[model samples]
Target: MKSDMAQEEDEPSGAVLDQPQEISFRRALLDRISPLISSTYTLRPFPSKWQVIRHKLEQLRSYLAAAGDSPSDSQLMELLQSVTYTAAEAQALASRCADESYTGGKLLLRSNLDVVSAKLDFHLKRLEEFYAAGILTLARAIVVSRPPAGASREDMRFYVKDLVSRVKIGDSQLRLRALGALNEALLEDEKYARILSMEVANGVASLVTLLESESRDVQEEAARAVDSVARFDSHKAALVTAGAVAPLIRLLEKPGTSMEAKERAARALKKLTENSDNAWSVSAHGGVPTLLSICSEESGTSELVHAACGVLRSLSGVEEIKRYMVEKGAVVVFVKLAGAREEAAQVQGIELLLRVACDDEQSTAVREGVLRALVRVLDTGSPKAKEMALRAIENLCAASPSVAMLDHLVVSGFLDRALLLLRGGEVCVQEAVLKAVSRLGGMSEVVKKAMGDSGFIPELVRLLEVRSLQVREMAAETLAGMISVHKNRKRFVKEEENLNRLLRLLNPEEKSATKKFLVAALVILTDSTSVRRRIAASGYINHLEKLAETDVTDAKKVIKKLSSANRFRSLLTGIWNS
Candidate 1:
């Protein structure tokens, strides 16, 4: 009877205590956030992860009871969050969020007021919706709240680090986004100087190690993230010391990765050693010789060549690096890329060779040798390479004037080969040869006549109607050069419609090179007094003046040069004498 009476007495008070009041879940969780955010700020006695989860469950049960038999809408949401994060790092989270002032007597937490106060829909149904999508707001919630000194050697740091590691690589986009966030937070100059942490370095190393992952995006992000982390000298040295260069170079050999990734890595490598031992290490790792082999491949990979050239370009700038490049067969590589059929490869290859060749004898040999090869390449390569090679030759000629290069190619019958191929070759190669011939400085009238005799005008005219911008540029340039020489100059003006077709491309519809070519061709029409009279008589000069007024062709230079007494006398003096 006494036990029953005591139980009856306790039941009344228990019922009153169990009759939950309406406490908001946000108020409870947000109130605790300061301690949570600050919890990992210092090393602490970490509870077992399960203990943290169990403590959080107890807190949720009590908080839910206080709100009512069930939680208020806000309290319910906090309870669900507790479930997600308690198993993650509950006590450390609370401690990280808590203020230093709280240790004396209070348990107040520092909330990321921005996150806490933001009105979020945390209903179970909405939470589940986000959870199903793997976008639990709490997971995103922890990102911004992280202390700027994000990684440390403490146990909580290890635990949090493990959490990130446990995040599956299956979600590439999310993983990349997470990497961005981590880089933004942990990769800081201050972090490097004062924080006394290699944790960031470890994180970066993990990212760089992913370069070998079969996943292209992972390799890309890994390279990008590695580039970002290499801002510090020590980290850069560590990465180089750790043999990261070879793997990055190997990734460049992968044909599938984006050019952006390859270039980014190339640039990073250049920056890392800043002309130190890493440049030579690239070769020691078989990087240079491998790059040389890649350059020799003619499979039409423009982007890959550009990327490979970028690595070479950087290596060519410093004396020590340049020497390393030379020793590693860079000369042979550039010589080959200069002769490649891909436009970008030829363009960048020439640019790369120009840099390497601009200074010393060895460099000059590579540059001149490549130039000689390109002269022949202009005859034999695909239309794209021929055009690109011509442009590159213009640049190369400015850097290293070598007519012997062209003379040799000519002696080898390269001009005839190019012209022969033009008539039967793809309109591209035909056009390329024409543009190339325009720039082929040391040419004889016999060669020019051979080109004109190859039925080049009709084919060029046919190509003028072709839609390719580069093709038209090449055709226009070829016709211009053909008209500049005495033997073929008359052939151009005799084709009445040729003037009209060249004029259209000479208009605003054309590219700059096309206009230059048209202007060159137009200047031929007024070469002599009789030709000028015929031009003046046939309305061709007036048409040119109108075109001069059109301004698209920059023909004023040609008109001004042609009409001047000096220019007229100089021109009608012989070449345009017809």
Candidate 2:
């Protein structure tokens, strides 16, 4: 009775005569149809293809999860294979959809594909607007995974040439994508960048046009691409000649631009201004005032401030631009940035101010404020920052009016930090520190005393043996300056090692300037009875007498002083008799 009832039910439903067989037939039909749905479904227009394909993938994932034991391993592999192929196709379509000439069919089919490609680009941008993070991630992953190894020089040139052409005529969305691709390729490898810069004709001109795009993404990406290409000195003049300066200045001046965009534009301007002609072009396009405005923008970001300061630092090398920057309150902005928490801004700001202070006309205007800012940087900034700070200090101290500011530097621990740097800082930092010390030590008694109290004498003495001739010369000159003060002379003469180092530098092979300072320092040290006796006993008088025969007036004077010193008269006569 049960078998008859089951057969009745199955016969009504299908050819199967049993429930299990009926279920098996339905599963087989589903397995065969799943691939078709996953592969050939193009129901939606190109604009909505991504969404339709995404939905198809999600359905496939769900069907795989629900399959349990119904579908064979082969069927599962086939379904997954279709999903993989479709995903690859979707990615390829997204990238190529922006290509207006991409046609995948015969005459009629080609027309249809072109229309679909245009629609796809339009809708892809819209989709990106809604799901920007996801799309960007996918795009970045695709771009990063594809290395530029297979891209020959000609291929890169053509690629950039095509993109530049598209950038001119394509929609805003396409232009942005093309510019973005250009930027990516430029950044990926220096070879591609060099090829684009040297081989492609309109690459830079198109980037300049993209810099003026209303889209900030296009503007920022274009500026960054310009920055990368400008790294090659060969391309700098080309970039500047392509009208990059005017738009870059405009982007920097535009209030509505993002800080990142302004930052990139400022960096590009900095690079462009590396050529003097480009600097003149920038000034002609009102770049200095715009950069000054950015420097003074209180709400500007650290990156923006840093980039602006860098541009100003470069432009300030031009005397005319420098005077303009100073007249426009560049000093005030630099003072503020030098004290900011941003290390890069602090470094660049100090560097720009240093340039300004190097000019005789502008040095007085920023001397006091620059001194204070440099002290702050030397206290808490990085090694590079410290080096810049010390250089600025040296420049500021070069002005006669800034002499009184030495006490402020000393009170702020400038002497202490400088001494520490001389001992263990980087080579650049050490050189800067030595310069600052030498300049300040020559200016005032208070600075000399502070330096002496900081144990700088020993450090200076040790520097006499340093490998750099400049360092050795600076050390000797500083010592001569210190001993000019009577109190410092007493202190220096009391240190046996200091006197020994000074005498050692009197070797005939030593530099003439070094020998002159050494002689001057020894002249003061010999004012002490004990130092006079020590020098007479050491027989350095013979070397000093030989040096006196030359044009070294100080050496001649020292010989007379040593011969006349009552404490050394008998020892000197005994040596002369021998």
Q: How many clashes would you count in candidate 1?
A: 22
| Deviating ranges (above 4 Å) for candidate 2 | 1-159, 184-206, 232-242, 253-260, 284-286, 289-305, 363-365, 399-431, 440-477, 493-520, 527-530, 534-578
* Local accuracy of candidate 2 as per-residue lDDT tens digits, 112-201: 445544443443343233223221111111121224677654445445555654564445666677677777777777776765665554
Taking all chains together, the TM-score of candidate 1 against the true structure is 0.46
Clashing pairs in 2: none
Clashes of 2: 0
Q: What is the C-alpha lDDT of each candidate?
A: 0.54, 0.66
Off by over 4 Å in 1: 1-37, 40-160, 163-201, 205-243, 246-310, 334-365, 375-386, 412-414, 417-435, 440-484, 487-578
Model 1 per-residue lDDT tens digits across residues 411-480: 6455556656665777656555665566663354555566676566766777666667787777776676
Which candidate number maximizes TM-score?
2
10 residues in a row with least lDDT, candidate 1: 112-121
